[model samples]
Target: MGRLSGKVAVVTGASSGMGSEIVKLYAKEGASVVAVARRQNRLEELAASLADAEGKVEIFPGDISDKAVNEAMIDFAVEQFGKFDILVNNAGIMDDMAGVDAFSDEKLLKVFSVNVYGPFYATRKAVNTFKEQGNPGAIIHIASEGAYKTCAGAVYCASKAAVVALSRNTAYMYMHDGIRSNCIIAGGFKTEISTSMGMPNMEAYGKLKAVLGTAPEPGEPTEIAKACLFLASDDSAYVNGAELAVDGGWCAS
Candidate 1:
């Protein structure tokens, strides 16, 4: 049951969805967790809920796109739990449905900053933290099927594709240092990002859901959390630079 015993993990986008679920599961499996998100109250709630679990949970509120914040997160984890062992780069946002003709520089930059740059910043700091301790660590990045297919807006798809590349590069760069990196290519799920982007009503959300040809039932966040656990734990010690598709077979189509 102690899959991550004696581990310390930093999870971004922990306010809700897969990030939140990962925090809970990690703590349950015996890893101290630092949950980072913009919503302080939500993070607090998560920490409180994890009280009495096998491992501790701490809340760190910040925007992940900021390099300083990512650095601070690593520092805090080291300060609070000694040395960091895992990082789950799960924070992401959906872009407005716009093709190339309708895309704006602002939109493109914002998505790339969060989905691409944010992970880069976090991975760098996490690797540095691991290096400082001379211990091997694991990095789990939550990418999406949009990375390979045009399920979402052009900008969103491009950003995810970049994330896949980033994860692979991180794995290769740190292979000699015992730092492993992997990407989870998630399929359509009932995430806040998927359900609330320009879909004014349920009907509109449903229409877009149908058009995307996603599975009839969206994947639950817990499903993704399980995959994160594998990557975070020693179970995947040899699995690096791997892209595991956790979609509901959406990528198959």
Candidate 2:
């Protein structure tokens, strides 16, 4: 049987990139997935593509930045699939590569709203559901190496740091309740998230050149999705509150 056989999972940002790969992987491994994202057509295509997979994929088209959407996404998973077991808080946005002095309040809000607040709301709802149903839960927050390294703009860095903290805090708070929360410190990867960066401050963008040079070739989304699969399955039952740096040794450099 597949690793996630009979599991029900909620994966945000499932319209494209890493989120899409995670949904595909989970379904292939036999998990019924609620692919949540804002693009209705993309979600429909994704769900249709998985029609022959070992499990099922249903679309939840909405913006996770809204608290109601986050809450409803989890509830939708349970309402549609009978129960909820995993939540991959993978929806996030990036900020322009600007320094603190060059950053704007608007950018900070936009970044944190999608990156931090969305996860916060989704996690809160997931925790309650897990406790009520008395089933083990797994939450994988897709953070960035920027959380600890100067690989991104100040706002992006700060946002991911919050995500890392949230993951650890949730893990500690719910360890005894059979819920696992972990952060994946990702390195440079080829994904559509760059579309959200908009534009970077030319001068401040140079700040990342040095550190970016140390990074290996960009990784594929499936590579990270594989690690997520491990954490989502019973394989990572003992691994909680961990920061698994899937960064190809870039952070070491």
Candidate 3:
């Protein structure tokens, strides 16, 4: 049997990149998933692709930053799947690689709204659902290596730093209640976010990261998905409030 057999999970940003991969892996591992994102077609495509998987995938197209959407996502998961056991707060955006001096208030607010507020809103709903159902829950935050290092623009880093802090506090406050919260400090990956930032190809990106001295190459979405799987499964039952750096040693140097 798969590690997450019989579990129910909700993954944000499920339309693409790491989020899409996570949805696929979760279903493969025997978990019913509610895949949440803003793109209806993409979500539908994902759901269709997993039609023969070991579990189910239900799509929810909406913005994770909206409080109502967050609430509804949890509701959809529980109402559709019988229960919600895991939440992957994976929807996030990046700001132009501009310093604080050149950063506009709009840019700062937008990044924080998606990266920080979205997780907060969803986490609130998930925690409350676990409370109402009297069940243990796992909350996974897809943070960036930028949260711990200064390799990117200020707004994005600060926003993710807030995510790290929030995850830690959630774990501390809820461990006794059987709720677990953790952050994946992921390194550079060839996701839409990187392409949006105008980053070079993955090989070029790896070369750039190599300047930091013997770091691993840029990671794949599937790599991070696997790490998330570990955290979401009973394998991580004793892990809480931990920052798992699946960043290919970017934070090591």
Q: How well does each candidate superpose onto the true structure, as a TM-score?
A: 0.93, 0.99, 0.93
Ten-residue region with minimum lDDT total, candidate 1: 196-205
Candidate models: Cα lDDT each: 0.87, 0.94, 0.88
Instruction: State the lDDT at 126 in candidate 2.
Output: 96
Model 3 alpha-carbon miss at residue 28, Å: 0.3
Q: Model 2: per-residue lDDT, tens digit, 15-104?
A: 999999999999999999999999999999999999999999999999988999999988899999999999999998889989899999
RMSD of 3: 3.4
- Which residue pairs collide, candidate 3? none
RMSD (Å) per prediction: 2.6, 0.7, 3.4
The worst-scoring run of ten residues by lDDT in candidate 2 lies at 199-208
lDDT of 3 by residue, 1-253 (tens): 6778899999999998999999999999999999999999999999999999999999999988788999999999989989999999999887766666666687788888889999999999999999899999999999987786656677887999999999999999999999999999988787887544544234433433444354567678999999999999999999999999987777777
Q: How many residue pairs clash in model 2? A: 0
Higher-scoring candidate on lDDT, 2 or 3: 2
The C-alpha stretches of model 2 lying farther than 4 A from their native spots are: none
Q: Which ten residues in a row have the lowest lDDT in candidate 3?
A: 199-208
Model 3 residue 97 lDDT score: 62
Which model, 2 or 3, shows the larger TM-score? Answer: 2
